[model samples]
Target: MKVAIIHDWLVSYGGAEKVLEEQLALFPQADIYTLLHKLGSQSPLIESKQIRTSGLQRLPIGDHRKLIALMPYAAEQFDLTSYDLVLSNTFAIVHGVISTPDQLHMAYVNRTMRYAWDTYHQDLAAFGVGGGIKRLAASLGYHYLRLWDLAAFQRPDLVLANSPFSAQRLQKYYHREAQILFAPVDTEQFAPAETRDDYYVTVGRLVPLKGIDLMVKAFTTSGRRLIVIGDGPQLDELRAMAGPNIEFTGKLSSPQVAEILSRARGYLAMAEEDFGIANVEALASGTPVIAWGQGGVRHTVQHGKNGWLFAKRSSESLNAAVEQFERLDWLSPQLIAQSAQQFSGAAYRASLRQQINSALQRREQEN
Candidate 1:
C-alpha cells in the first residue's frame, strides 16, 4: 500500500513528532506531508523521509518555527486523495485532509486543539493582537479554525488517541469515540540505576502549561535540591526567578537526559499532561514521580506505589506530596522499573501493528 503520513508540522522534536517517527518505521515506504518542514533540527529518522510540505514552505521566512502560528490558514492547502492510505499524526490541523471513497484515512491524535476557540482570546493577547480590528481578525480566525477543526474529524476512517484524557476530549469536542493507545516509552534506553543521586528532576519544554513554575515553588518550600532540564520561551524568566536550590541545565542530548533521570532521587511533574512520556521514563529509570493527580497522570501514576500524586496543582499540595514521598519506603526500584514495562517501545510497536492490520482488514471487507 502507498501510505501517506500526515503531520501538523516538523519544526521541533516533541511527543507528537516521536509518534510520527514510530509511524515511519512501521511504514518504511510512506511519504510524509506537513504544513512546514524545518529540516536538521528533528530526529534523523524524519530527515531521511520523502517529505512534502504545504505552500507555506515557499515563504521567505528563515526560521520554519514561525510557521506554526500560521497553520490555521495553511490547512486549506492540503490535497489528500492521492494516497491509498492516509495516516495523520495530528496535534493541530493536518486532520483537515480531505479523503475519497477509495482511500482510507486514519488519524493519531495527541490532543484536541487547545487554542482554536476555548483559549483563543488568551492566545491572541499573547501574540499582541488585541482590541479593535485585531480583535475582529482574531474572532474571524477563531471561527474559521473551529469550523475547519470540527469538519476535519469526519474525513478520517478511524481515530487513535494517545491517552484516555485525549479520548475524552475527542468525544466532548467532536462527539467521536477514539481508540486509546498510550504513547511509547523507550524503556531499554532508560534502564534502572543501582543507586540514585540526591536531586529531584523535571524535564519538558518550560512553558506556562508545563507548570514548571509550580514545581520550582514546591521544591523551594520542600527544601529539596531540584534540577530542570529543557528550554523554551519561559526559560530565561524562570531561571531568573528560581531560588538557590534549583539548577537549570537547559537542553541536553537524549543520553545526557537519561543519565540524569537514572540518577535522580525522584521526578517532579506538575503539568496536567495529556499523557506524560517523561513520567514513564522516570519510572523506567527507577525514579518515583511526584505529580499532580490530574489528566492522564491519573492513569500513568499509581499513588504511593510507583509514584505519589498530589490531589491539586497548587504548590502547597505538591509540597505535601513531596513530604509523603519522603515518608514512603515501600516503592522498590525493581517494581518501579517493572511498572514502566507496560509502555515499552516493543509493546507500542506490536499494538500499533495490530491496529494497522485490523484497519486494513476492515477496509478490505468494506470493498
Candidate 2:
C-alpha cells in the first residue's frame, strides 16, 4: 500500500520527531511530508527518508514557530491524493493535511498547539505584547490559529494520543475522544548498570520552558552533583548560572545518554511533560526520577516505589523532594527496569497495528 507520513517540522530531533522515526521503522518506504525541514538536525535513519517540505522551508528562519501564520496554508498544500494511508505524527500543524474519504488519515496527536491554546497568555507575555495594537493583533492571530487548529485537529479519521494526559487535552480542546497509545521507549537500549554513580542526571532541551533552570538552581545552591545532558537555545544561560557542582554535556548520542542514565543515582525532570518518555527511559535504566508532580509523570512515578515527586515548579520544591528522597531506601534497579517493558518498541508496534486494523474494520462496516 502507498503510505505517507506527515510531521509538523524537522527543525530538531524531539519527542514528536522520535515518534515519526518509530513510524518510519514500521513503514520504511512511506513518503514523508512536513511543513519545514532542516537537514542534519534529525537522526541518520530519518535523514535517509524522502522528506518533502513546504514552501516555508525556503524562509531561512531559525525558529519554526516564526512561521505560525503560514503554517495552516503550508499544511493544506501537501498533495496526498494517491496515498492509501496517511499518518500524521504531530504536536503542531501537520494534522491540518487534507485527506480523501477512501484514505485513512490517522493522527498521533501529542497535544494541541501550545501557542494557539494553553500557552497563549505565556506566549503573549514572552513576546512582550503588553497592551494596545500588538496585544490585540497577537490575540487575534492566536484566535484565528485556534479556529484553524481545531478544524485541522478534526481532519484525521482516527486520533491516537501518546498518553492519557494527551487524550484528556484532546477532549478538553477539541471535544474529541482519542485512543491512548504510549509512545515507544527504547527499553532494551537503556539497561541497568551494575552499579550507580553518586551524581543526579537530567536530560532534555536546555530551554527555559523545560525547567532546566529550576534543576540548575536547586543543584547549584545545594552543591549536589548534577549531570545535564542535551543542548538548545538556553545552553549558554544555563551554563552561566550553573555552579561547580553542575556539569553540562551538550547533546549526546542515545548510547551515551543511556550509559549516563544507567549509572546515575536518579533522574531530575522539572518540565510538565505529555508522556515523559525520558523519565520512562530513566526507569528502563533503573534510575528513579525526581520530577515535578504533574502531567503524565504522575502516571509513571509511584511515590516510594520508583521515585519521589515535588509539588511546585520551583527549586525549593525539587530540593524538598530530594530531601525526602534521601530519607528513603534505594529503589530496586531490576524491578524499575523491568517495569518499563510496557512502553517497549515491540509493544508499541503491536498496539498501533491493532488500532489501525480495528479502525479500518469499523470504517468498512459503517460504509
Candidate 3:
C-alpha cells in the first residue's frame, strides 16, 4: 500500500506528535505531509521520514493565528491522489486534506478547535481581545474559520478521537462520529523513582486554558510547594502571580520531566484535557494525579483511589482536594502506575493496528 500521513505541524513533540510517531512506525514507508516543521524537533523516527511541507512553512512557525486563516487552503493543496490510504494526525486543519473516492482517508483528531468554538469567548478574553470593535472583528474572523472547520472536520472517511471527551465534541459540533483511540504515553521513559519528593508537580503549556493560574492560586494560598513544568505565553504572568511556593521550570527534556514526575508527591492537573497524556505519564511514574474532575482525566483519576478529583474548576475546590489528598495514605504508587499500563505506547499501537486492519480488510472486500 502506498500510504501517506498528514499532520498539522511539527513544532512541538506532544501527544499528537507521539501518535504521529506511532503512525510512522505503523507505516514506515509512508510519506509525511505537514503544514510546517521545525526540522530535528521530533523523535528520530519522525526526523528520518520523508517530510513534505505546505506553503505556510515559509511564514514564522509555531501554530500562529496568522497561519490559521491560511491552513484550510494549504491543507486542501496536498496532492493525495496516488496514495491508497492516507492517515491524518491533527489537532488542526490537516484533516481537510483532499482525497479521491477510491482512496481511504482517516484522521486521528485530538481536539476540536477551541478558539473557534467552545472556548471562543474565554480565549478572546485571555488574548485581551474584547467588547466593541475588537470582539466584533475577532468574532467575525473566527466565525468564518468555524464554518471551514466544520466542513473540514467531515472530510475524512473515518475520524479517530484521542479521548471520549473529544469524541463527544466531534459529534456535537461537526455532527460526526469518531472512534475513540486513546493517545499513548511512553511508560518505559516514565518509571517510578526509588523515593518520593515533597513537592507536587504540574506539567503542560502555561496557558489560561490549562488552568495554571488556578493551580498557582491554590498552591500560593496553602504555601505548598508546586513545580510548574513547561512554558508558554503565560509563563511570565504566572510567575508574577505565583507566590514563593510556586516554581516554574520553563521547559525540560523528556527524561528530565520523567525524573521529576517519578519523584513528585503527586501531579496537579487543572485543565479539562481532551485525553490528558501528561496525567497518564505522571501516573506511569507512580505519582498520583490530583485533577479537576472534568474531561478525560475523570476517566483516569478515580476519586480517592489513584488520586483525588476536585468537583469544581475553582482554586478553592482544588485547594480542598489537595488538603484531602494529603490525609489519604493508602493509595499505592505501584498500583497507580500499574493501572496506567493501559495507556502505554505498545497497547495504543496494538489497538490502532487492529482498527486499521479491519478498515483495510473491509476496503479490500468492497473492491
Candidate 4:
C-alpha cells in the first residue's frame, strides 16, 4: 500500500507525536506531511521520516505559534492523491488534508479543537484574552475556524478517537461516530518496581490546560511533595505559583520519567485530558493515580481499586481525595501494572491493523 501520514505540526514529542511514531512504525514506507516542523524537537524516530512541510513553515512565528488562522488552508494544500491510504495523527488542522476519492483518509483525533469549542471560554480566560479588541479578534478567528473545522470533519473517511471522552465530543459536535482506539503506552519500557517513594509525581506539559495551578494549590494545602516532570509555555508562571513542597523537574528523558514513575508514591493527574496517557503509564510503573474524576481519567482509573478519583475539579476536592487516599490500604503493584497492559503498544498495533484492513476491504468491495 502507498500510505501517507499527515500530522498537524512536528513541534514537540508529546502524546500526539507518540501516536505518530507508532503510525510510522506501522507504515514504514509512508511519507509524512505536516504544517510545520522544528528539527530535533521531536524523537529521532520522527525526525528520520520523509517529512514534507506546508507553506506555513516559512512564517516568522516559529512552530505555528499564534498562527492558527492559516492552518486549515495550509493543510488542505497537501497533495496526497498519490497515496492509497492517508492516516492523520492530528490534534489540529491536518485532518483537512485533501485526499482523492480513491484514497482512504482516516484521522486519529485526540479531540475536537478545544480553543473553538468546549474550552473556548476557559482558554481565553487563561490567556487573559477576555473582553476587548483582542477578544473580538480571537472570537472572529475561532468562529471562522469552527466553520472550517466542522466542514473538515466530513472529509475524513474514518475518525478514530483516542478515548470515549474524545468520541463523545466528536459525536456531539460533528454528529459523527468514531471508532474508539485508546492511545498506546509502551508497557515493556515502563517496568513495575516493588519499592515506592513518599513523594507523588505528575508528568505532562506544564500548561494552564493541564490544571497545574489546581495541583499546586491542592498539594500546597495538603503539604504533599509533588514532583512535576515536564515543561511548557506556562513553566515560569507555574514555578512562581508553586510552593516549596513542589519540585519542578523542567523536562526529562523517557527513561528518566519511567524511573521516576516507578518510584513515585502515586501519579497526580489534574487535567481533564481527552486521553490520560500518563495515568496509564503510572499504572504500568505500578504507581497508582490520584486523578480528577472527569474526562479520560474516569475511563482509566478504578476508584479505590487502581487509584482514587476526586469528584470535583478544584483544589479543595483534590485535597479531600488525597486525605481519603491516605486512609486506604496499600494497593497491589502487580494488579496496577496488569491493568495497563490492555492499552499496550502490542494491543494498539493489532487493533489498528485490523481496522485499517477492514476499511480497505470495504473500499475494495464498494469499488
lDDT of the candidates, in the order given: 0.83, 0.88, 0.87, 0.88
lDDT of predicted model 2 = 0.88
Clashing pairs in 4: none
Model 1, span 1-367: residue lDDT tens = 7888888888778878877877877888898888888878688879987789988988999776456557756765667667888888888888767778878788888777777855666767767786898789677867876887888887788898888998998888888889988888878888778888899999999888888988887777777899999998899888777889999998898899999999998999988778888999999988999898888888888987989987787888888888878887957787888999988777877888888789889878978
lDDT of 4 by residue, 101-209 (tens): 9889999997679889988888888778978899999899989999999999998999999999999999998888999999987888897776888999999887777
**Clash numbers, per candidate:** 0, 0, 0, 0
Alpha-carbon TM-score of each model against the true structure: 0.93, 0.97, 0.96, 0.97
Q: Which is superior by lDDT, 2 or 4?
A: 2
Question: Over all chains combined, what TM-score does candidate 2 have?
Answer: 0.97
- Of the two candidates 2 and 3, the one with more favorable lDDT, higher being better, is 2
Best by lDDT: 2
Mark the regions of model 3 whose C-alpha exceeds 4 Å error after superposition: 60-63
Candidate 2 lDDT tens digits, 1-367: 7999998888888777777777887888999998888999899999998889999988878888878899999899999999999999988888889999999999998666876788788867866789998888888888898999888888999899988888998999988889999988868888999988999999899876789999999999999999999998899999899999999999999999999999999999998788988999999999999989888888888877888888889998898888889888976899888888998988888898889888889888989
Q: In model 1, where do residues sit more than 4 Å from their true spots?
A: 62-73, 117-133
* Consecutive 10-residue window with the lowest summed lDDT within model 1: 64-73
